[model samples]
Target: MFRNARLSLFLPFLVCVCANGAALAQSLPQPASQNGISYITGGVGEDEVQAFRAAAPGYNLRMTFASKTGSYLSDIDVTITSGAGRSVLSVRTEGPFLFVRLPAGRYQIGAQTRHITETRKIQVPAHGGADLRFYWEDPDRHGVMRVCKSCPDTARP
Candidate 1:
């Protein structure tokens, strides 16, 4: 009888925890699909951004967009193409951050806003990953572009 009472008391707590967990899970961002490419694309909120960053490593590339003054920018166009110039991933994120899964290879990553387009070359390791950051400056305020450490930009076309 005592054991039964203990379980009965714990049951309410368990139910409450499970219900809260389900709600939180539902609030998390879900993977999106565009042009047959499946990607995780949301980080507008504080918690959602944390979740996105936490889940980033599993993806092949983490693309982030920001202004020249270091302000986060959203809805920027991002495109990933193979070394042979084939489109691999093309997406426009609602937030400043986007995570995509690509096969290990060399590719060109292009990020564009209304007035500027920044391009970088990246080579995903056969066993590791990479990060691409686009800092968009104004037309006249443009400066040197930064390349990913893992991938070298040997040639610019």
Candidate 2:
């Protein structure tokens, strides 16, 4: 009887781990199938390069402000809403990547930093994974979007 109970508990633990495995493998935008409207996070595909472009929804977006160079942005406002304008995840900082799971629909993507506010639309497939990066500028500086290469994944965002 004790062995049976232990097995039951261990079985559930394994199932849960598998269920959340993808969440651990990646942090942003889960993998999706075609049909749903998903946001292509980071600067992935800005154009309609994929064959099933219209059949699905997605976008390649990037916010460039402090990302130019040495100027590290202090604050950032990223508002991710569903197709119906329902609130999803509203992030406010230059931290780690953010991932939100939705039933695939129209979405409004926007970001605001010390001196800029940008908004755009993204269509995500049923289960497609999108990539997006927000780079905030400082006042009036222009340069290349530089990410911290030395930044460690184990490090806190």
Candidate 3:
């Protein structure tokens, strides 16, 4: 009888803990699927940034877009194609950053915003990953648009 009472009390506490954990997990960013590709694209909030950082290494391609003035850009369309020119994944970034997982190989990445469209060729190694930065300069300013495959990460705004 005493053991039964103990379990009954402990069960309530365990239920509460499990319920809280579920809520916390829901609050974190989750991956999205499109065109048979599963990717997570967000950097708007602290939670999203943390989620990207934690998952980026597992992905072969990590990307971010910005203006020549160093302002982050969003709502950009990104496309990834294999070395043979077959489209692998196409996604639109909701924030400045986009993270994607692909089979280890060579790919051409293309990013397009209202201001400019840029393309880059990159090789995904057998392990680890790479970062790419697309600088979508303002056309009015006559600045050159460029993509930096090895650019350093700037301070998160």
Candidate 4:
């Protein structure tokens, strides 16, 4: 009887803690699905970056966007196509990080910003994830576009 009373007393506190945790998780950015592919995009702030890092393990593809100078970037239009030429996911990212869960296969990722588009081909392993980075040239302070010297021939506009 005493043990039952102890568990009863602890149950309400456990419930409250679990409820608060669920609420907090709900308030964070949630994954969206398209064509059976699930993805989440956002890393605008430190807390959000941490959240994305914590969730990265569950995703099979992780992408990061930045400028040639290494500053993080956002507002990129992204599309992922399967090796069989089927469109898997297409969305405009609101932040610098994109995490996707994909089957083991080859894929093409296209990212566009400031009227410049770059494409990359990647193979997702069966047991682990693939990480891809897309870099764009930073516009001049006067807002004029400049050539990216270090960009590959394919990435050049």
Candidate 5:
């Protein structure tokens, strides 16, 4: 009975999320020369994956994730959301680096942590080359997710 009551309470929240997702979907832009988003995903050891998303009109983005000496990050997934909150591009990495193509627009790029999720928005120009970045802490200590526009520094962990 308790589980059922909890599920009922959460149902509306799930619906709202779905509704917002639908409202955010927008058409991908196609330029006379090219159409698609460009992305890069990879990190070293524990910080194995790093991702960058740039809008067509945006500047070139450069990303850097802080890590230990030997190990690197892995399994980093980045989704590019339009300034309006629609998911415009999505990329996940299985190997060291993944390169994707995208149209130019304002984008919100999110970096994943075991507990926390970090997000950064970037603009990509029509041709190529934009500088953008995001950073987050490991969940080894906090066990909670924290979001940030820029990389975050914690008291501990």
Candidate 6:
């Protein structure tokens, strides 16, 4: 009787948890196709990120965008080209993750943000997938001069 009572108490909680997880997964962005290439991009929140990670294995090419300091980046313009230089897929990512179903071959990926672009070449295996990460230097940490109003500037020879 004790075991049956415990099982009954746990079942409803399990069901609710499973239902909520399913609903969250369903809320993720749907896969899209362009020029016969299928892809999905989005990972704006924890739930969406988890959903993307769960779906990633089904894709042949998985990409992630971030800064050198490890902050996630979005609104990246992504372009993938075949080894022969033919454009296969081009789209702007809505979040930090982009998953693509591509044929087994060599491809070049270009991700652009804030007018700066980074390129990478990758190979997709015949059976599994490839993961690519693109990291950009944080703008605030580089190329910007900080000035102190109260400190006198020393002239350099």
Q: Model 1, which residues run further than 4 Å from truth?
A: 1-24, 34-36, 138-157
Q: Per-residue lDDT tens digits of candidate 6, residues 21-129?
A: 8977796799999999999999998889888988988898999999998999999999999999999999999999999999999999999998899999999899989
lDDT of 5 by residue, 1-157 (tens): 9999999999999999777554332222222211254444443332222112222223254444433332344566656677888776565544333344555667777866464567776775666666543444443434555577475757355
Between candidates 2 and 4, which one is better according to TM-score? 4
Candidate 6 contains a number of clashing pairs equal to 0
lDDT of 2 by residue, 1-157 (tens): 9999999999999999776654433433333322342333221232221212322233333333246544545356778777887776565543323334555667887877654777777775666555555555434543434477786543223
The order of the candidates by lDDT, greatest first, is: 6, 4, 3, 1, 2, 5
Higher-TM-score candidate of 2 and 5: 5
Could you tell which candidate, 1 or 5, scores higher by lDDT?
1
Give the per-residue lDDT digits (tens) of candidate 1, residues 44-157. Answer: 777676677667877878888888778788989888888999887787888888888777889998888875788899898877678888887643445546578677655443
Question: Each prediction's Cα RMSD?
Answer: 9.7, 13.2, 8.3, 7.5, 17.3, 4.9
Separately for all candidates shown, the number of backbone clashes (residues 3 or more apart, or on different chains) is 0, 26, 0, 0, 46, 0
Give all candidates' CA lDDT scores: 0.78, 0.51, 0.78, 0.87, 0.50, 0.90
Candidate number that wins on TM-score, 3 or 6: 6
Highest TM-score, which number? 6
TM-score of each: 0.69, 0.41, 0.68, 0.74, 0.44, 0.85
Off by over 4 Å in 3: 1-28, 138-157
Lowest lDDT 10-residue stretch of candidate 3 = 137-146
lDDT of 4: 0.87
TM-score, prediction 1? 0.69
Clash count, candidate 4: 0
Model 6, residue pairs in steric clash = none
Give candidate 5 misplaced runs (Cα > 4 Å). Answer: 1-71, 95-98, 138-157
Tens digits of per-residue lDDT for model 4 on 83-150?
Answer: 99999999999899999999999999999998889999999999989999998876433255448867
